[model samples]
Target: MVPISRLTVIAATVVLIDQWSKQYIQGHMLPGMSIPVLDGIFHITYVLNPGAAFGILENQRMLFIAIALVMLGLTAYFLKHIPEPFRLMRLGLSLLAGGAIGNVIDRVQTGHVVDFFDFRIWPVFNVADIAIVTGVGCVIYTLVFSTFPTGNQENQR
Candidate 1:
């Protein structure tokens, strides 16, 4: 079984970093402000998202919060069933939980998520978003590539 301490540490790290970065952005930049990190490529643009990814369902803060909480709960419930030594799965779930909580904090406190890290081609996003997406990708990778030992297999061992 995945160790709860390890999972908690990973999640806490992500939340801390996400919150710190967002706070820094909020203190340093105004909404709609942009600072070029890479000419015409990447930038630090501060924006407040009131809805989900890609700015969809705008102004639906409560709905997004509810969804995130449910997802986090389900992830925790499933994590227990995954066999041990599955580091990637643990990391994935931890990051996912961290990111969700980070955004939830923002929604509860300000009714919006603070986003930065602009790549001119895509909608602006923040550290928490990165963690969430990365976590999901990791989870998908683990599910596709890792083989979990079944009860029968464990019994044989």
Candidate 2:
């Protein structure tokens, strides 16, 4: 079983990073402000998203709220079923939960998500997106790379 204490630590870190980044952008960056950080390759642009990724279902605050709640619930349920040996995966999942909640809190409070990290080739996003993406990537990596060797491999070892 994963240690509850460790999971709490990971969750707290994710929440802090996500919330702090959003707050920093909201407070310091003017709405619609775009500052090119690396010529035409990277920029920091402030934006508020009222829906899901890429601003889907725009202005459907209630739908976003329900979706976030369902996601958080499903994640919590699956956390216990994840492989016991996959601590990294567990931590990653915890971060996902925390990050989702962080953004959900923002949406509930302001009816939008604060996004500011703008990539040249992609839609603008925030720290919560980074956490969620990284978390999912870790789970995928664990599934693909950490599977137990079978039959002949185990016998040979």
Candidate 3:
């Protein structure tokens, strides 16, 4: 069994870093301001996303908060149930929970998610979004590439 405490640390770390970065962006930049760190490649652009990607379903605060809470709750519950062998999956779930929390925190406080990272070609996002996407990718990789032992095999360890 992987202790929940260990995984909680990972989740908490993500939340802290994510929140800090968002705060930094909010403090140092104004909305729609873009500072090109690498010309034509990357930039730090401040934006308030009031909805999902590309501003879809705009201004749905309550719904977004409810969904985030549900997602966080589910990830926490799953983190407890998964066995130690599935470390990547657990990490992914932890990250997912953290990201969900970070974004939800912004929503609760400002009714918008604070975004900063920009790649010109893609919609601007933040640390929380990075964690969420990376977490999902990790989960998908684990599910596709890692095999779980059958029946009592886990107990035998």
List lDDT for all candidates, in order: 0.90, 0.84, 0.91
lDDT of 1 at 142: 94
What TM-score would every model get versus the actual structure?
Answer: 0.92, 0.86, 0.92
lDDT of 2: 0.84
lDDT minimum window of 10 residues, candidate 3: 147-156
Per-residue accuracy of model 3 over 10-129 as CA lDDT, tens digit each: 888989999999888878888999999998899999999999888898999999999999888888788888888899999899889888899999999999999988999999999889
Clashing pairs in 3: none
Displacement of the residue 78 alpha carbon in candidate 2, Å: 2.1
Comparing 1 and 2 on TM-score, the stronger one: 1
lDDT (0-100) at residue 24 of candidate 2? 85
Worst 10 residues of 2 by lDDT: 148-157
**lDDT tens digits, residues 11-126, model 1?**
89999999999999999999999999998999999999998888999999889889999999998897787767778878888899999999999999999999998998999998
Stretches of candidate 1 exceeding 4 Å from the true structure: 150-157
